[model samples]
Target: MRITTLAAAAAFAFAGSLALAAEPAQAIRQNLLALQPDMPIESIAESPVAGLYQVQLAGGRQLYASADGQFLLHGYLYQVQNGQAVNLTEQAQSKAIARQIEAIDRKDMVVFAPAEAKTHITVFTDTDCGYCQKLHSEVPELNRQGIEVRYLAFPRQGLGSHGAKTLASVWCAKDRQAAMNLAKARKDVPAASCDSPIAGQYQLGQMIGVQGTPAIVLADGQVIPGYQPAAQLAELALRAGK
Candidate 1:
């Protein structure tokens, strides 16, 4: 009886390892592409859940699937630890976002900073967004509080919007900072064309979970949706930097 039990356990272990192996990644990718040919996949790897796989799409959004690629889950994954529901998926996303933010060049963003900034926050802004304009008005005070503000264009109204056009103009302007200020104040910036990062940044905002303007991203990849007061946002940045 004991010998038979040990043999059965060995068989189960082998099956489990096989179920978690890397061979399923190609199948998952191929099958997913068949469903949505335009979907861009960044990576596929085994998830924390046994026999499940994590699929990271271009721009940081994710989904999960069974090892065989026959089943899919498009929601957050949680782990119950010590009676607490820990958001494992969100934690992974936060790390990924931090890495993505780190990869971006500073020159691509419109920046307002103190000579010696204590900490900085990235804001995804739409020129036509009321809340975004409100936040911009307080940038000077925030800079005074040692909080640098970096702006990335996100025309919430889609790529063809007037906001997107204005943002492109700002990017093309000889004086980007001044153009941005005029835009936030609802003034017209000279229409110009150049190789712009607006489209890319707008897409990036979508990938990073920015559904609206004035989205504040801290250094640690924590996103504060909508507008935040200068003092409060500066405090948050200081903490994240530490």
Candidate 2:
């Protein structure tokens, strides 16, 4: 889980020429499994770079491995063309976020929206995060501007912490919206427990590069990492929708 860049470089330096006859994806999986049998590999696919494959690991970590599976690069991948450097890693992550979001049902989200919403954004929020509270306070204004806000729990502390427990309570409450508001306001909601999606949401947040609370995903799968004013967010959402 914690392979240093220098270590990876040394690894590649020693084992860069092991060719494989199998498909790139299968060969990479086999190579990685041989290295660490217990490491969870979620997916493998062709990367933007020729002869390099993008590997998606459990918990959303990504790395680039050579097509032959002998070299691994543990950093961002950039596509340079026409005097510009485009972050190919981020672009791929955005597409993956879009696909994952599409699989989520609205019923699992806590939403605030106008009767006829122009667009909706998904937010990964933590109950104890100050910026998350600031963002929640603007939900009504965002709704008024015809932008729906859907919230998924991303407790800064792991699932066993008080923050996570509080989020679970919010989801268990009969009035989920009110409970969320109370938690955001730093007030305690009645402790409750149920079969909730908090754990899955937290994992999803990690996969989509949500390092902090109030991480907002716009309609086009563009990730805005912090709080934006209601009016500005509404404008951004409308533009992203188009």
Candidate 3:
């Protein structure tokens, strides 16, 4: 009886919204919550698609909803332009990711760059990750290719784990770049702690969909999971810049 009553009340609210959808955005939000009480909304904005609204949900999920809140779309939205298909959805996501990554100041990150790097990549790394160590080894090569490599601490083992403590130590070190090298080489770094962005960076990685160590974010905000050869990575960075 409880379940039936709740369902009927939600149905009634949705029916009212459908009849008075003059405020599309509000109607969408209200009806969506009525239908799915667990889903949380972050923002709603007008979309390029006529009569549809873009809904950004908590945890970085996105979707398109009908003006009347009668339907929702989960797939990518694209348009044909100049004989080519442009993925509007992907473009938006990339721009948003780029903005979030750019919000982190370089001074807080361990940076390796040539004097005249044309592009940069932000990597979420962990000292205990074997592939992350391998990736660090290729930083010099990437720098030679005119691609800057910036490191953000992401302990794959989660906060308070051994990996997180090691990362915090690296961030807290006087010579962060040197400390990073030592830690990546499986050497002990003097335990230290101060105002550091280790936790914040790790949280940012989680918000942006980082699943593992050595996750790379290109200049355009496109995420490349896993390791790539220096030559290949440089090529990709250049392409993303263009």
Candidate 4:
């Protein structure tokens, strides 16, 4: 009788293991959606932390959930090993940002590059922002240091506003770089219209956590919010490449 009881217990344990192992990621997603139907979930994958799954939402937001989808955590997850703490969340976000940025064609950007470009940075810029104007003023110096600067429009005001119209004019102008310069100098851009990616770029900026103008995204997908001197930015870009 004891032997039979032991075998039954073993069978139950095996079945439990099977149940845990078969918990589908889709189930977790469904559970999340049930809670927040409006939240845009992008992807789900197993996290470094045991029993936790990483959930990536639209616009680079991240969260963690239990394998069974019973609990969800909304914060950064750190892995501590050998007396060092590594931010797993930031690592994942960086990779996502890199992929999204790579998908952008150079033709869509106002690019300023040196003859021998060593590195490039993408900037989400606004025409009327003071810091963006300051950053644009340093573009010549940045170009001299072999760092290409690619500009994507991100008007602080939302679509259909005056700022957006000005940026759309810049994109529509025959010489985008010249128009950008004029707009940054507070000069009125000639009214022009085209099939522009300004709105998409603005949404992309929001997804990637861009809160202000002149947000610089380095080759390594690190975002530097606000202005940095030309030399300092060049040095940082070079170091990131290494």
Q: What is the Å distance of residue 148 in model 2 from its true position?
A: 1.2
- On TM-score, the leading prediction is 4
Q: Report how far residue 219 has shifted in candidate 1, in Å.
A: 1.3
Where is model 3 more than 4 Å wrong at Cα? 1-22, 31-42, 57-60
lDDT of 2: 0.86
Any runs in candidate 2 off by more than 4 Å, and if so which? Answer: 1-22, 58-61, 81-83
RMSD of each: 5.5, 10.8, 9.8, 5.5
After superposition, the stretches of candidate 4 with alpha carbons farther than 4 Å from their true spots are 1-22
Sort by TM-score, top down from the best: 4, 1, 3, 2
Q: Given candidate 3, what's the lDDT at residue 121?
A: 95
Clashes of each: 0, 0, 0, 1
lDDT of 4 at 32: 92
Candidate 3 per-residue C-alpha lDDT over 1-242 given as tens digits, one digit per residue, 9 for 90 to 100: 99999999999999997656548888888989998997768777778888889887643557899987889999898999999999988877777788778888988899988889899999999999999999998888898888989999999989889999999999899999899999989999999999899989988888878999899999999999999988889999989977
Error of 1 at 212 (Å): 1.7
Clashing pairs in 2: none
TM-score of each: 0.84, 0.80, 0.83, 0.88
User: lDDT of candidate 4?
Assistant: 0.88
Q: What are the per-residue Cα lDDT tens digits for candidate 1 across 1-242?
A: 99999999999999998765757998898889999999878899989988899999876678999878999999999999999999888877777887888788988989998978998899999999999999999999988988899999999889998999999999899999999999999999999999999999988898888998899989888889999888888888999888
Better of 3 and 4 by TM-score: 4
Residue 119, candidate 4: how far off, in angstroms? 1.2
lDDT of each: 0.89, 0.86, 0.88, 0.88
Compose the digit string of candidate 2's lDDT tens values, residues 109-209.
Answer: 88887888998899998899999999999898888888888999999889998889999999998999999999999999999999999999998888767
